[model samples]
Target: MKAKMEHKEKKIKKVWRNMNIGFKSDLHEI
Candidate 1:
């Protein structure tokens, strides 16, 4: 259970990181 939770947290972190980069790029473009 702990391992599963950790995996999910990592996934969420990665998604958020990608989103952050995308937003930054969009802002820069604008």
Candidate 2:
């Protein structure tokens, strides 16, 4: 059960990182 939670956290982290990058690029485009 603990392992499953860790895997989910990792996936969430990756998604958040991608979002941050996208936001940064969008700002640069302005």
Candidate 3:
């Protein structure tokens, strides 16, 4: 159970990282 939760957290972190990167790039475009 703990391992599954950790895995989920890692996936969430990756998604957030990608979103942040995209947002930064969008701002640069503007």
lDDT of 1 by residue, 1-30 (tens): 999999999999999999999999999999
User: Each prediction's TM-score against the native?
Assistant: 0.97, 0.96, 0.97
| Better structure of 1 and 2 per TM-score | 1
Provide the overall lDDT of each model, using Cα atoms, as 2-decimal numbers. Answer: 1.00, 1.00, 1.00
TM-score of 2: 0.96
What is the lDDT for 12 in model 2? 100
Candidate 2, which segments miss by more than 4 Å at Cα? none
* lDDT of candidate 3 over 1-30, digit per residue (tens): 999999999999999999999999999999
Clashing pairs in model 1, backbone N/Cα/C closer than 3 A: none
Model 1 gets an lDDT of 1.00
The residue-by-residue lDDT of candidate 2 on 1-30, one tens digit each, is: 999999999999999999999999999999
